[model samples]
Target chain A: AQSVTQPDIHITVSEGASLELRCNYSYGATPYLFWYVQSPGQGLQLLLKYFSGDTLVQGIKGFEAEFKRSQSSFNLRKPSVHWSDAAEYFCAVGGAYGNKLVFGAGTILRVKS
Target chain B: EAGVAQSPRYKIIEKRQSVAFWCNPISGHATLYWYQQILGQGPKLLIQFQNNGVVDDSQLPKDRFSAERLKGVDSTLKIQPAKLEDSAVYLCASSLDGGQGQETQYFGPGTRLLVL
Candidate 1:
């Protein structure tokens, strides 16, 4: 079964600090990876996606993710965290040409000033 | 250009009551999906439709839960005698063509359901 795992349930970081959210996936074959962010009382928005080619993919809102095939991970990173960055982040995986996506539990990011 | 649309931003009903939610996918999108997202958890796919036809509904609870996309554009999901566990945010998403590789799905604002 294909699945996504977000190890951290909640994380707090100081504003202007670097941030990294860990994600791991289990799939039988090459997986389509994605990172989505949701703000309070808002629908989820796509941050970035990794299908093939370059390991690093840039997304909206100044977010980026690196897909590590060997580790089966697609981790999201940000160089400078802002107060607006406090939100829930989810990692999702899908099979080739598969419309259905498997999302992780999600990580709640808290930014402290 | 508009994203997916859902109706009734919030609904509160007593347990054992019936409730229904509606969704309008993006214009020209051929694939529609309904998902259930419990608090503190990820969204779980309940049903999928491919242009008025059912594609994947294995995860949908047919006993008390039902959904349809008759015109292949707008869809509806209903729960009869709703249970407390059924309280969650119902999300609607759409893609141009699910058959294509790496199809990006755009989501709606979601309906928050509360079963008292």
Candidate 2:
């Protein structure tokens, strides 16, 4: 079975600071990776996804993620984060062209001004 | 295009009671999914339907949870004899191709459930 791990439970960053959220996945074959953000009391919104192609994939809201097959990781990064970027981030792994998505425990991001 | 739609934005019920949530997928989407999100965790997939046919329900608690999609368009999830642990948000999503490779899924606002 495929599983995703987000080692950090919470991360605090100041506004305009660089941000990076770690994600590690375990899958036998090539994996489909995704990043999602959820605000308080709201459903998740897709930040980005990596199926195949360039290791680095850019997503909406000024966010990007890199898929590193060597380390079994796909970490999300942002040059400078805004206060509105504070939310719960989740990393998910999916199987071959289907509905199953294994999500990580999640990491809460707090932005301090 | 409109995103996925879910009804009853909020629900409150006593333990052992019954509740149901409705979801309408995107107009042309071929797949619909239901996920449960706890307070401090990521959403966990409960059930998935590919055009009114179940594709996955492995994680669903069949004893107390049931879901169905009719006519390949709308879906309903019902929970009977709910427990305290049942308090969470139920999110509905849909994808055009139902492919995990590249298809993007649109999510609804979700229905928050609280069981006393």
Candidate 3:
């Protein structure tokens, strides 16, 4: 069985400030990881995914996540936040079970100017 | 290319009533997926189809939920005698090839279902 954990339920950051959202997963063997963002009234958009290769992966909208196998974490980070970047973020693990994904609870981000 | 499309952007029904939601995946996409996203929760995979054949449906509640992807194209998910807990956003997603678990899945706007 695979599971994901997002420690932060809600986060608030001012514009131009740095932000980081924590994510951890439990899975057997090497796993495929992904980050998704869901805006108000929209669908879940893929931010980035890590299959293999560089531990640090860059995503759309200036967001990036580092896959730390040692810690079982794939934390999303942004050097600077924008007001429009506010949304809910989710971390998922897959690749072992027919592309089936187990997602985290989600973290809501609020950006203020 | 257009993204996944789902009909009835919003649906309202009472408990014990039946409801159905439709989805049309991207052209030439061989894999389709259905997910349930409850308020304040992440989307949960309900079903996955590979060219009209079910690949995984272990999380689906078979007693009241049924889904079909006939002709390997469009799909519909139905709920009979819906429950209040069934109220959530039904999201449809499609990928180029489902063989690799790393394929990027494009999502639809999702159909909001409200059961009162």
- Local error of candidate 3 at residue A36 (angstroms): 0.5
| Candidate 1 accuracy as TM-score | 0.98
By lDDT, highest first, what's the ranking?
Answer: 3, 1, 2
Q: After superposition, how far is residue A26 of candidate 2 from its true place, in Å?
A: 0.6
Q: For candidate 1, give the lDDT of residue B68.
A: 92
Note the residue pairs that clash in candidate 2: none
Model 3 interface CAPRI class? medium
Sort the candidates on DockQ, descending order.
3, 1, 2
Q: Model 1, which residues run further than 4 Å from truth? A: none
Q: DockQ of candidates 1 onward, in order?
A: 0.77, 0.67, 0.77
- Backbone clash numbers for all candidates listed: 0, 0, 0
Against the reference, the lDDT scores of all candidates come to: 0.94, 0.92, 0.94
Tens digits of per-residue lDDT, candidate 3, A1-113, equal 88999999999999999999999999988999999999999999999999999999999999999999999999999999999999999999997447888899999999989
Alpha carbon lDDT of residue B37, candidate 2?
89
Clashing pairs in 3: none
The regions of model 2 sitting more than 4 angstroms off are: none
Error of 1 at B50 (Å): 0.8
> For model 2, how does the per-residue alpha-carbon lDDT over A1-113 read when each residue is reduced to its tens digit?
89999999999999999999999999998898999998886778999998888999999999999999999999999999899999999999986778578899999999999
